[model samples]
Target: RRYEQRIAAAARRAADRWAGYARTGDQIDLGAEMRHFALDTIWRALTGHPLDQATERELDRIATVVAALPQLPDGEQAGAAVAEDLARIDAVAHAAIAAARRHEDGPDGPGVLRVLLDAAELHPEYTERLIRDELVTLLVAGHETTATTLTWLYLLLDREPGARRWALDAGPEGSPERREAVQALVSETLRLYPSAWILPRHALTEDTLAGHRVEAGTDLLVCPYLTHRDPALWPDPERFDPARFGPGGSRPAHLGGYLPFGLGARACLGTQFALRESVAVLELLLPAFTVRFLDRPAGAVYSITVRPDGPTPVVLAAAV
Candidate 1:
């Protein structure tokens, strides 16, 4: 709730850029556009400023490193592969930290970076390096996940166009019913495409697992994708139905039934914020413009996060 104003501001900027597309008759890559909007939103929350293209271009190395992580050779080769990218990421992070230390406040206000800087004053433990790590983590976690989820939401709406009409028809703009419907759209998209498809966990002691045995200190992977799509847990699991997240909808009752943001304490802290940001953007865009897909992705690529395998070229037009 504290971040609502910044989220709305960010969404307005993105909506303006999108409106330009509708006005100019230019094609755009929807995936990239979503990424930009998300990056801008989180960047504002983190540093109280919009994401400039120059900084965003350098920070894009974060995605590059993430994608290359699974393919890198073992040991030192892995570090070598992403060394340049890491340096680039570090430069941006340190710059932000320095700015925060200087008490820089963006147009919105002082962001979380300012808070972290203040904490450092009272505690010696909050070192510069630690601050940098926190910023970068916020960037990767908040930016990539929300961006990808939104891209998937738009793609899903492209396929299930009726869902759009259903949502818009549910209630008037700015109404609670309309907001719920919009959130339902984001929820269903997340069910189909969780930010972190595979969450890594480890066993503290030996235990039985689904009628199988587990060894102490064993590494485990919890796959929310498979769990969310289990036909037993979700009837018609593969279907893109936003109503599933609506009131009286048949969402599973058990704790493990739905874990888009993971479960327990380790669950994403920004879950609510992400939903708010998504809804904010959708509220402004959904009723204003209709995206016409000029180039749809043929498949999905599952790396650090699952995303459209190819570019998503789209043209924006005034909603009829």
Candidate 2:
């Protein structure tokens, strides 16, 4: 795949960080490390450049704002609460756009930004503001979701050490079997904590079938996080079992099931990208290191995304 080399490079950079912790026996914040790694991966894919410290520092506010989103007041007041952080995020976005415009063919080659810029030539609607919005969306959605899933994945693996060995034992690194196992791990993680756990939709033209009335103007939310855990759809749904997706695995008997990526036409476009990059990083790190969490959150936090309520600090042990 065109993204294989890029994903590998990003994964290697992340692996190096874990290797450093392994050598020093230092406790690292798993959540922070995963977030950084994910940002770097998506940043490179968007602009063909690695995430530098200065930019990453600014982008860190993305999390702050995202966390506050659920609590913030609606409308104009919402902007006031996160104004400073939004400004910083916007600054970073504009800078990236200008840089991409100047260097359409970046060091790593043309990236998603370049493609957007090229389209602006024929479509005037792709204004600077729109470009910035897209960049910020890709930055937040691309990295944040991936980072959360990975953080959860390792946490789950720590609780179930055998699962890590099971994935590694599926086959050697880069083998199809191993990849499948790694994906299963990610699939399970997402099942438990789906990205954008709750998605809101508006009714343009109301219609209903299950003995319910129709309203032309109404808001509805679809929650994959809830559906993924439905006992009826997923037997023993609370268990973190990846075998549900393995060969000969039995899926929910009901036709409508497992909405991890979501449901219908507007489902996540980056399902494949997210899964691939996740599996890529796991293929490298899972085999190379074992993490012992210094501390685990007492529970999960529900916000723009569902994540561990507290910090995930861990010490890594490199495999012998």
Candidate 3:
């Protein structure tokens, strides 16, 4: 309960910050703002403190490292390419861990770091380095997925304007119907642009898949992006149709047919958190403001994650 309250409070702070920009008609980078919002939420959960601008700036290196991973050579070469950014990220992580070790809770409360620190007292394995790794892992996983999903959701809305109206008209503000409608918007957006589009798995033993034989130790990439768009799985696959997730909407019955967050036991841990935060922000912003893009991205970037290939500059206006 306490944790939930802290997350909600962090989200409220993010919404309030965005509302200030929207009210003044400020031009903002939609993707960047979403990143900030997500980082804030996760930081609070990890440290019980709202994310500071300095830390946020330092953490930008995470994105750089992630973008460069696909093309960089393995081992030393890859390490050399991102060595500086990795150092910055490491410095931030160490600092946060040290602070958490001081046993000083943030304004919200003790965070996951504090819990880890407490465990370190009894468990010798929870070394400072391990704690830093956990912190960085949470930071990366917590923000990037949600940020990309929210950015794509807005972009999709820009292309399909009627969908926004359809969602808003579902019911009054804060109503379950409206929330469900907004969630459907998110679901459809994810179908088109799942952040973690690819999942790789290694075969443990020889097996047959779809009448094809697979040898043990073989590597395979399970691409949710491709599966979500398969013509056999989705009718008019390229179409941006939120109705596909709404009531009375027709969809494939197979679990493998639509897995924006992967499938089975190893699915994303932040699925519920991501959906809740996305809907919370949209619930406020959708009814109160409409975004007009000054310029849109050229296309999608296929890398560690699928993302808009360019900047998402936009101006915010009060909803009419």
Top candidate, metric lDDT: 1
- Give the alpha carbon lDDT tens digit for every residue of 1-320 in model 3: 44576667766776787778878988899999898888888888889888888999999888888888577657896678698899999999898888887867789878989888888899999888888888898899988989999999999999999999999999999899999999999999999999999998889999999998999999999999999999998999999999999999889999888888888778888788888888887888788878899999989998879999999999987788
When sorted by TM-score, best at the front, the candidate numbers are 1, 2, 3
Tens digit of lDDT per residue, candidate 2, span 1-320?
Answer: 76667788899999998889899999889989999988988888898888899999999999989888777756776667589889989998888888888885556887889889999988999999898888888888898899999999988887788888888888987899999989999988888888678988778897894687669888887788888899888899899888888777777866457776776788787788888899989989998998889889988988889999999989999996
Query: What would the per-residue lDDT of candidate 1 be over residues 1-320, giving only the tens digit for each residue?
Result: 77888999889999999989999989998878998998889999999988888899998787778777566646796778589789989999998888877878888889999999989999999998898888898998998889889989999999999999988988998999999999999999999999788888899999999999999999999999999999999999999999998878889899898888999979998999999999999999999999999888898888768788988999999887
lDDT score for residue 271 of model 2: 80
lDDT of each: 0.89, 0.86, 0.88
The number of clashing residue pairs in each candidate reads 0, 0, 0
In TM-score terms, candidate 3 sits at: 0.94
User: Model 2 — which ten-residue stretch has the worst lDDT?
Assistant: 253-262
Candidate 1, residue 217: how far the Cα is off, in Å = 0.9
Best by TM-score: 1
Candidate 3, superposed: residue stretches over 4 Å from native: 73-81
CA RMSD, predictions in order: 1.7, 2.0, 2.0
Error of 3 at 183 (Å): 1.0
Candidate 2 off by > 4 Å? 73-81, 253-255
